[model samples]
Target: MFLFRWPVCCFLLAFHKSAYVWAGYDVSEVTCSQGLSECTVADEMPLGISESDGADVQMVTAKVEVCCKDNAPCTLCLLVDAELSIHVGEDVDKSHSGHDTENDREEATISTASVTLCYKTPPTFPACKRVDFTVCPTELKQKVAKVSLVITNPAGVSFSSIVYIYPSKALHLIEVVAPSLNEVCSQNLQKSIKDCYMPTVNSVINQEMNQVELKFAARHKVCIQYEADGRCQSWESKTIPLHSVTPCLCLQVWDDDKPRRSQSCPFKNMGFLQKNVWQNLTASVRHGRMNNKGQMLLWNLSAPCRLEGEVWPCRWTSGHHCTEIEGFRQQLENTTWEQNSNVQWVKMGVFEDINLQLSPCVMVNLRGGGLHLGPFCSHHIIAAARWRWNLLAVAVLLVIALAALMSCLRHDFVKKWASHSFRGGCAEIGRKGHVVLLSPPDIHDGFSEVCGLGSLLKSQGFSVSVDQWSRMEQCNLGPLPWLHSQLLHVKNLGGRAVLILTRKALGLAHEWSRQQPEALQAGRGDGNVPQSPYSDVFMASLCLLLVDKRQGRTGERFLLVTFDQDVVQPPGSLPEPFQGLHLFQLPSQMKTLLCELAGGGNRKVDGGKSKAGWKWGILDGWKLKTKHTTCSQGAIPTQCK
Candidate 1:
């Protein structure tokens, strides 16, 4: 009985040792290759051990790997390795493996375990190759997602684990820089589209992310309303071609489907710069008061973008020699906008009188792009103040010189006026009522006519001083002394002095008086009283009288006349002094002589016929009787003695 009992017990024990038992399963470990989760998964997972069975079993772990493409959605892949544990009765073969089991009847038997994944925070995520998680959410706190994973065993029991998935850090410091004006004009379409780039610091930080390039769209148009607003109404929305000479240009950039803010008016200040340049150039050329002393011209310009260029001030000399101004050639650096310190003050040397003009020019290279832009200069040259002042001074000097010359030429007229003013008043000859008729020598022809002329003048209210009237005085004072005294009296009275000129006296005007008693002749009116002294004094005065050039062919205080018998006498035949005097033919010019003694020379008499009617009648009768008496004496009046 012992032997049979031992065999059965032993078989039962062996069966129990060979059989597997089912127990509650639990996930020992989980692994996720993606680092965006709150729960950590180990690299190597250790399978759980069945305590009663005394056998080790390994449970497969899963790796949650993520794959993404470009800026599109990201994918999350769950690769699971699962093994099923099954429990068999004691009759089952014991050679299945070396693993032993306990007496628990429940077991997980399926070869495959079903895994279900769902998100709690984020409702949906893309599948293996197409899954996408939020990289950057609107709220930073919502960037994390709660994911639940369940592993179902063949025993119908479920094992679940919760994981928090936080999205990976995304690119945050990205920026787009637009192309410059130089690139816009000079670059081709393909190169221009690729010209836009990220900011320097941002591109350095995100080296891998920087591979994602941006595209640009440029619109060239005029900025009509730049002052108040940027209103560029372009007719066509399509991109226009750009050139260096294009006017009123602007630019815009695009990033992917969305466009970035545009950078317009790359050359907005160009017009203002050009206007100021012209003004400065014109001012530089103009000559000032101290232009020859040299000066300085400052060039201050601004730009929206960086620029590289050269500038120079030039001078054109009298010989058409063109040369740059001294100390004014400059190479431009990266000049920026709105910086006052960038002003370049150029000093110019002394501009000689031979300099014809001056100007300045600027050569612009936009953005240091090597392409050369046309030079800008002024169109018109400005006249200098110093030159204008010089011309005015010369003109004034010429006018002054001309006036001086004219004054010198008319010195006689001016001298007379000055003398008259110096004397304190005008001469009152007619008002003095005094006249002197110095008689000719008694040997002269027309001696009676000479005496008659004095009488005729006496009838016209003149106090006539004549040798004939003054015979008693002449006989008492001797002829020479009396004659000298009468001449002196006429000068002191400011009176008129008349000398009756005859053909014989005029012919002997320049001859010396013969002092011999035989040469002396008695006057017909003198009654055999030899008047040699009177003749000598009269002839000497005639030779001394000379015409004054200053007074223009006339004397101030002398009157000369010839009788009708000497009518053929020409003024040129007389002495120099008498030539300027009017040769009056008697009776015809007798009224004119009266007008002369009345103060003005040969001027119109307002009422000579009525006021001097008696004088004219007596003078006409004397003239008619003298002519008749001479004709009766057998003397032809037309022929002078």
Candidate 2:
């Protein structure tokens, strides 16, 4: 009988303890699958009883749980020691049914008691047999709930514990204050290109609020709906990193099972650098008005995003110098392009001269990135009046330089051209006759002056030979023999002879005359006596003069001429045969000389008879002068008519 009774008592004790174990559990002590409870334990709070010194105090341990299972309603379960001695105040019973006299002192009678719960204030469940409260799954959607439980004993002793319950579907948004896009770009500039990432805009969102929270999931996205004609036209979604988030874009949170929420937009306000947004931006540039400060470059910026800041930093680079345009930023914020205004016309900078050749550009703050809204270039602006004046000045300088060059070459060029034209029979001479020019070797540049006279006569239809050009032939044939040959050739061609006389020539002639009288008296009148210490050509000329004078020959075959630069000796100072001949000064008496060379004695000649009746236009002013005067003769001559 004692063994059977002990086994029964053990079975009853085991059953009693197991009853409360299912209702009340310490989640830390037990795994979720170890329990007989069908609900999955979402959260649990344990209120462990402290050791009590007072015998009146009841020993109690309590725990609460928010539990749910696969799409089912959530329940708030309160678990407590079922063996605790507790009774409602009004329903207390003093009588006790003792299990046995020996066991009555060790175990207290289990009493029926009520537990009350209150949540969200004013909503209370009182005197409940079971401590389970049914909660709709949608009621606690992704949120936390705090519940308060109150247990009262028959003696009016009250015990209470607060339980924080989290439902199975509860979610929380962890707010993270991220760096702005500008700061991210700057900090990651040193990173490798393979590691560097640039975020592209997914969609343009119109946000009504300035701030909201983002819900992070497997796929983080920004979604926006564009409207047209009062209806939604299209939906745009973009994948973006957390760093690229801004208040202007809308966020959508979703999962594979179901879309948790949609239209969560205007993300939490992340401070931005307005200057950086415009740094990589593109815009149109225009020239600004010129003021007292100078000419300015105007940047017109119209963007969909908001631009608001105290300053916009930029650099202006020209050549090797870079200048910060900080003043323009202040000017931009203060001018018509106000803060929060999307459209702005900003004055980039001022330049002293717009016509400078410098190609200045505006550099935005984005250094490594490609050209943003600009390096706006500056162009040279030249006024019409100033350009015309510069052109005129250049033309005047060219004309002056050309005149100076032509002046230095005129004498030599005309001399060579006239000689060539006469040789080619292309001059006005037209192969008319021949003439010989005789010049004394003692005067300065006397031979060159005689050559000039010869060239002019050659152009007037008279073939002329001067001693300067024949010096090589004169060296081969003696000067006297050469002079004789030239005279014979002139006589055969019916051409006259010219003696270019100067002060030196007359002096030499006086010396020769004085010596000739001594020679004739010495019985040597054959003209072989040394007359003067002069060139053989000069002595030969004097010998010819002597022979003509002694023979009493008239000086019709010979004429005397002088250049403007030479000192013309008076005809009375000349010898007998030379004094009777007409002494013509060239260029002034050139027509008269030509007439005499044409065999017209004392005849007046008008050279204008062959005029082409056309004036030279502009070139007439540039015509070369002969001797001290220009030639007055026209194209044709009437000298021998």
Candidate 3:
């Protein structure tokens, strides 16, 4: 049985001899037998791989081939570029020289495997070409993706070092940096759109995860609405919407009030980076008031005084009810206070809660409106104070100067009044006169007759001397020997002497010698004189005697006139020397006594003309008449009528 089994196995083994699986680098060359054509190796031969487009993958026959043993009928099969399951498999038989096996149930194969990926002779990538890729879904964790890249090179050659890909989270972040991703993400189109939603990534920042930052610089229209109970309206709402249909759509920060106030709300989701918010927003901010209070800077003032009309009211309105406001502002020096219109008083420089990350702008809210506040300069305060001082000084000086001027004027008026009172209003008259009139002085001395006589005499071109009068009695002279001297001197100077008689003088006319001669002896006795009971004959005698003496000095005229309203005393009804003197009828005070003397330049009078006109005075004869006239028996003669 062993011999028979051996013979059958030997026959089967001899029939089932398999071909040797030989696979290695191909080392073949085409040759010319007759030594006419040059032989070339496969490496030197031109494969279509060298002439391929940068985007295509053209297969080149590798230096791998299948070989069989001598004279043995065998099958030889070869495979090139063995790869992973993810790759599109390409089975290429470089050569087939072996025959099929005796069993022929399964085909025999041989292949060569090398370091090959999806690579080209001259490797390059498309705009968004994905290179190494891997998806790692670790247990109980978000799946992490990994990707790697190779630099596209011009030279068609493999790199020396092997490449590797590690798991990373940055693969998702890389989408933002891709060239294809940049084309779709542009800037904001409408003013209502959120600034951050429109990405303007100038530079990539975060080398770390959450810290990946961007630089954004642009302006946005923002309007804010105040919460009913909030203290600050500006701080709460950043943007306001104009379109009523879309309350969230914000087109402008400020708008014409004609369409009424736009709906405003808090916009916390603005995507723009706040890094450049100060720089971008500063230009649009104006010098504006928080309340009605003027936009004023802090210098030094009362903390919470009522500004009234000077500032905007710090209040808020809801329906018909206005509420008080309590708020703080951000500034160089932070302060806080209440508003008056809002029911409390507030100050200009006030601040709120602060931190290191402060922005350049602050919110200022008042009753009627709210706005963002920008920087203001308070440096002019010092200079303004100086100006105020200067103005005050000028005003004080003006008041002082005006007071001094008024005082000077008052003193001048007092001095002038005193001078007028003391000096009286009359000019001084000395012993220089061409016509002299003797008359009695009265308490109320100024009379119309005296003034008319003086004026008439002056009009006739004679320098007349009468009484120089005043309201005071300083210049008054009572009858004295000096008066007698004045009358005699006037006669010596060829001046006229006129005697005037009033009722008082006429009643005591004859007693003139007894009363006045003693007064003359006393030489201007007593500034005042008492009235005396004297005879009219005595007065007439004295006047006659005086006239006789004065006429003896020169042939000047002696005017003796009786002013009696009761009777017309004719010149012939008089005593001896006075009988031919100028005698005329004179009504007491109604008319002036004018001695119708001579023509102009005659300088003479009718001393003794009664009914006969222009009779010259008998000077020697008047002395004879005065000697014959006696007084009282011890008295002067009464009268010869």
Give stretches of model 1 more than 4 Å off: 1-429, 443-445, 512-531, 547-554, 601-624, 627-641
Question: Which tens-of-lDDT digit does each residue in 215-235 have in candidate 2?
Answer: 343344334321111111122
What are the lDDT scores of the predictions, listed in order?
0.36, 0.39, 0.29
RMSD of each: 42.8, 40.2, 48.4
| Cα lDDT tens digits for candidate 1, 1-641 | 44444344444333323112211223222321111122222221112211212111123333343323344332233334322121222233344344534222112111111122211112333121111121111111322222222222211111122222221121121121223333433433322233333211100111222111222324322211112222333222222211111123333333334222345444454543332222112112223333455443343433312234665556534442335656645666642322222122222222233233354333334333354432322223212322543476468556755775586578664565455445533232253345667655532235556556665665555546665444423422345666556557666655566777655455445232322222333311221211232354465345334423334634445666667454335556665546555445675567657656655333322422212211333345435234422211111121112
- The TM-scores of all predictions, comma-separated, are 0.25, 0.26, 0.21
Candidate 2 off by > 4 Å: 1-431, 520-534, 564-566, 601-641
TM-score of 1: 0.25
Q: Output the better candidate (2/3) by lDDT.
A: 2
What value of lDDT does candidate 1 attain over all alpha carbons? 0.36
Q: Model 2: how large is the Cα RMSD against the reference?
A: 40.2
Candidate 3 residues 1-641, lDDT tens each?
43443344444333322212222323221211110111122221112113211111122122111233354321212212111222111221123334634222112111111111222231332111112211111110121111112222212222221222111111211110111111212322223222113322222333222122223333422222222221322211221111111111112232222222223332223323221121111111112344655442222111111222122112212221223223433332212333333222234442223221222122332221233221221223223433554586458546755775697597794565355445532122122235655554320122444444544454443445553221111111113433554556565655556655544443334333444665533322122221211111223334554556555622235655444444235545443334344444442211213323322112222432222122222221211122232221111111211
Clash count for each candidate, listed in order shown: 5, 3, 41
Ordered by lDDT, highest first, the candidates read: 2, 1, 3
* Candidates 2 and 3 compared by TM-score, better number: 2
Worst lDDT run of 10 residues, candidate 1, spans 198-207
Candidate 3 lowest-lDDT run of ten: 632-641
Flag the better candidate by TM-score, 1 or 3: 1
